[model samples]
Target: MNITTPTELSWIILLQSLIPSYKKRAERDTSVPDAANKARKFAQRYGEILESLKIDPTCQGGPLDIILLCKLREQVLREVGFKDIFKKVKEEENEKAISLFDNVVRLNDTIEDEGKRLESLVRGMFAGNVFDLGSAQLAEVFSREGMSFSATCQNLVPRPWVIDDLDTFQLKWTNKSWKKVIIFVDNSGADIILGILPFARELLRRGSQVVLAANDLPSINDVTYSELIEIISKLKDEEGCIMGVSTSNLSVANSGNDLPVIDLKRVSQEVAYLANDADLVILEGMGRGIETNLYAQFKCDSLNIGMVKHVEVAQFLGSRMYDCVFKYVEV
Candidate 1:
């Protein structure tokens, strides 16, 4: 969260970062008969928002940050008559991820070594991070390959990580268990279904209560409470779920945010109440875990998981694109 340079918050630079994906409406649905027209109208409105922001003489030469950008995006999307532009996309992603989730979990259960099994699951979190909206071009270009997504994720490995403290996290949590865990989720596709859900279930296996904290509304492709509930409801009906964690042991809490950025100071009553006993808080994705809460402090153990997806963020963190971070701290 250090302010290293003014360009880090430059409005123009941030807009440029999103231009390509916005132009084509990355991962957009054109399969339906009228879906193309719907997408076109949506994109037109989106472009109008961007244009308005650019022409705003008052906003000239302002310092741009991720939180502000996200807020602006949310506001514009709402005003444009589409509160959830990714509603269809999110649904598709959730469905695809849930369909392949059994295999994702099966791979981990096959690993005989306990530590390795845990490590593989942790890596799954990083691998699934490719589903980010900022990197939606990558997702769209590659196509959401469902069960075959794992092979694409393998490319993420063998890359230098910016902050890798998995060994330390394993050292502490392998034989120990926390009373409660707060899994701050991100993205709609495999990122949540294949990554955080399995990780949370593993915590459940160790007798930890889990609170899946998500957005109160929509922002980018970040999962919202409505979207998360849909996914959870599906998992509940599955027989012999991974780790056999009951759906009752899992709870959902809104973080009281409509944007991708998290403002921990104002969480929902549910999250505030559940987090009281939270000994482990896992903040996932670059927006929450890095941009806003990179230096966030708490009265308990915390873990920040993210993949550097944007150039500015990579430069700010002194990492490269797709570089993963596994930062752990106890306070």
Candidate 2:
């Protein structure tokens, strides 16, 4: 008698889960929905692609990376408007590069109106609820308070409307005791800076361990692990030095008050070492769709965490990177 190996069993279980089935949510009536079917189809297609690439989804990389990829794939599904098994559009569908570039140029010019034109465009591409919290003008005008025009402009015209809160989600985790926070970093841009800085601050304040998982520089202007190391090396005190960890491919100098950096490739091993005594894990998303799609996939396989679809982000991007994360939610 041949007993199934763990690897074989895992594949079987994964395949079985991918098959369409009825699902019932907690505190909800039991019913069969196409969500499962959609997920199954996506899985199948994804599996095919991975197979073609000769990569085993289960073991091509660390679980953390896999999880990030899953999260990213989910974002792609949303952006491509393929939430159902019946309707799916690949990026190649819009591979008209020159035309897309023209549209982007047009998008930049259309934001000139700031208040009306920009809002309208966002609503059109991402739906009205994208800014349900309120438009950029919903808050106090900092421009009138001696802030620089550039600062005010950046704030009001966020690239991806993660939320005003995201613009300042910083915290101190001194008493929180979190093990690590994963940052799914994207390009170095206004949105990426706005989304992560605040979150890092808050995590530091709460004393939660933090990990900024980002690609190696210099793809995104956002902080890379290598860059972070230099910054930490010169750290003097904790006042302005928000502490966390960054993952890239370089060693960073840790002077206690500043955040540390880790190579992305070694994330799993580093995480295992840290998780033995931490409180929470935070994953920061890259501000771009491709990065987000990759992050989603990695998160699913590794952490099993749900990535929030920031609808406003898609509206803010105005359709260039439509499925970046914010496009999936209902308006």
Q: Which candidate is the best by TM-score?
A: 1
Report backbone clashes per prediction: 1, 61
Each prediction's RMSD over C-alphas, in Å, is 4.2, 18.2
Best by lDDT: 1
Question: What digit string (tens of lDDT, one per residue) describes model 1 on residues 1-331?
Answer: 2233455435445655565465355225344345445545555655565555455523423344566566665665455444565667678778889988888877887888878888888888987877776554464654444334676567774634888888888888777788889988999888899988888887777788889999988877889988898788788756635546665677888888887768788788888888898898989998889878988988999999988876777887898777888899977
What TM-score, over all chains together, does every model reach? 0.84, 0.31
- lDDT tens digits by residue: candidate 2, 1-331: 2343444344333323422221111111113245445445555655554443233434433332323333434443443334322111111111222123233324434454434433333232222112111112211221123223123333333345433222122122112234344444332222223234333444444444455544443220233445444433433134434333232212222211111122334444544454344334333332233222323333211221112233333433343322323322100
| Displacement of the residue 206 alpha carbon in candidate 1, Å | 0.8
Pairs clashing within candidate 1? 9-64
Q: Quote the positional error of residue 252 for candidate 2 in Å.
A: 6.7
